[model samples]
Target: MGSHIGGDELAVSNPTRAAQEISQTIFSLDLGGISTVILNGYDAIKECLYHQSEVFADRPSLPLFQKMTKMGGLLNCKYGSGWIEHRKLALNSFRYFGNGEKMFQRISEECMFFCDAIDMHKGKPFNPKHLVTNAVSNVTNLIIFGQRFTYDDRDFQHMIEIFSENVELAASAWAFLYNAFPWLEYLPFGKHQRLFRNATKVYDFLLQIIERFTQGRVQYSPRHYIDAYLDEMEQIANDKAASFSRENLIFSVGELIIAGTETTTNTLRWAMLYLALYPSIQEKVHREIDSVLNGRAPTMEDKQRMPYVEAVLHEVLRFCNIVPLGIFRATSQDAVVRGYTIPRGTMVITNLYSVHFDEKYWREPAVFCPERFLDNNGNFVRRDAFVPFSVGRRHCLGEQLARMEMFLFFTTLFQRFHLQFPQGSVPSLRSKLGMTLQPLPYSICAIRRQR
Candidate 1:
């Protein structure tokens, strides 16, 4: 059931195929000394990650991750008090700034700019990747820096390009090998080299911003994450062993910008692809928006009234299954899932693709049917198996902000324009894998809607 992928590795690219290869839901691969346990079903994943959260909450510090983050960031840090404190601080900051009316206003303001950029396409086919990325990154930028960048800003664009390139490279098998074998770093050339180069550039870029924020008397009223962090660091300066160090700030901001930009931006791109693929679905969503607000810009309040639109978004998140293999987690202590023993420090991969497409949990899991999320009464029904963001104490911290961006940007674009495959050209829903499952670059015509 476990076949060698190549060179001392056993692999499972497709969850359903992997399940067929091995009858059990929980199976392990001995990648040399590294043990990777794949949790392939919904029940098994929930049992370990959701139920035994503390036991399986730690992120494994692989070689590549160690080199990239140095265990300073919130996402890939080992499970301990330091991780907890960093996560708590980040959560508090996000809640303080990313909640209630102001949050939606900020998102909507960016959404307007996004719609305007799309309108400039003027019904011609064009790649929406940069436009979407720019808008999404701006939302996060505003939250993290108390400022936004112009779309034409050269420095900002280069930084984002490098961040995305590194993510794609890091997600490759080469990077996995780099993590498995640390000596690869000593070699003169490889994708790892390029990844390291890009990472340095991105970090240096971030460091410059950090220096600007930390320079001189900190008399500011804590404008953003940096300023707020400075205030916190100053308050805790008396403690020499504080977790809020300068290194953590750089890594934390890098992780926030990289993750925050990638996930929501890619999700919106998927939304665009799906809308173009299914014209009827697009029409229904447009109808719902038109009926709900009558041409007024969509607000968070309007989301509740538009069940079909909500259903579309839910389906998009579930269907796309962006983070197919959710971020790797490791067992902090010995743990058991579905009667299988998972030793301490074993690499744990929650197959989110399987959960989202599990036949037992979803009907016609392969089909792009928003109706699956809609009840017979036409009310939006939530499913427990929809774990695109994964579940547990360590799930995506930006879930609220991500959801806001998707809804605001998604509906606003559809409200103003109809996205369609250009002329007679057809685009596939096939995705290119990376740190995130990104839709292959495609073009769509955004014809303005006469509402």
Candidate 2:
């Protein structure tokens, strides 16, 4: 089944169809194995998933984290009593540290820097992947370490490049093989080992950053994520069950940076590509921006006035949820759902693509249409299926910032220039699934938009 995709078995090239057929067993049908259970349908998937007191919210065990991190990775932990403590502490810490007026100012300042950097590209043919990731990463960096890096910074670029590769590898067949079989991970394939090694290197860097921040080596007031964690650690110094330890602190930063930076940047990349491939839609967006923005950097307030642009952004997310099926979850214990008994440890997944593109909820699910999100008054209206940031207890920690980041960066860029794909090349708008759904590597020319 690992290599079965795109083969003759399905005889179809559609990802949604393939996903539906392949994943019809969690509540409706069952394949014969104990370890393998496929979640079927959107409602059954959501019902069985959201009810799990998060007991099944544990990520699947993988060799890289298990062996490399010694099984203490925050992202992989089960959502039991202990995990609940950690999750709550982390969420509280995020709220305390981020989204404040000062942080919003920081985000705004960095975003202007981002605009200037793109201004250098000058609407030319270029691969904006690293730049886009770097800009978004800088937001998390400021939140985590209270620092910024130049685009050419060697170490920073290495980390982003390696992390991006890891994201891609996570969706590759190789990772699937490694996760399913523990022993094969040790084999000398440079691909598998290198990715894990780079991850450890990243962890080590994160740990060092944590140590430096704790040691007061970076100087100035520590107002970012790590600073908040250190502060919590100090206050909870006497609490026996405190989850604000050094390890959890590091993991929180890791999850925040990785999850926060990767998703927003990838979705922006996809949006740029789609806009480039389709000019009339791009023109409409530009027209909306012209009326709403009036030649100024888009303020957060401008979002309400700019309906078409906002709807287009929503459509971009709807069509290509970076983590298409979202993070895989498991069952808390044996429970009956949709007339079927699911055992504990069953891998439960939410097919976001299913929800986003479900014909029941959407019209012309295959085509790119932002108007679905527009109301009669032309305000951006959200649908129940708009779970790009996810829903329920474990929604994205950086949802607020991610939304702000996407709207700000996307509208600013589009208002300034028209994105165009390379002449004579029509790139596929479909994403390749991984831990995140990412667009294939492609370049686009950004022709400056006429005033």
Q: lDDT winner among the candidates? A: 1
Error of 2 at 292 (Å): 1.5
**After aligning candidate 1 to the native by TM-score, how far in Å is the CA of 91 from where it should be?**
0.7
RMSD to native, candidate 2? 3.6
Candidate 2, residue 293: how far the Cα is off, in Å = 2.0
The C-alpha TM-scores of every prediction are 0.94, 0.89
lDDT of 2 by residue, 304-374 (tens): 88888888888989888777767766666776765667667666667677677676678877788889998
Best by TM-score: 1
lDDT of each: 0.83, 0.71
What is every candidate's alpha-carbon RMSD to the true fold? 2.7, 3.6
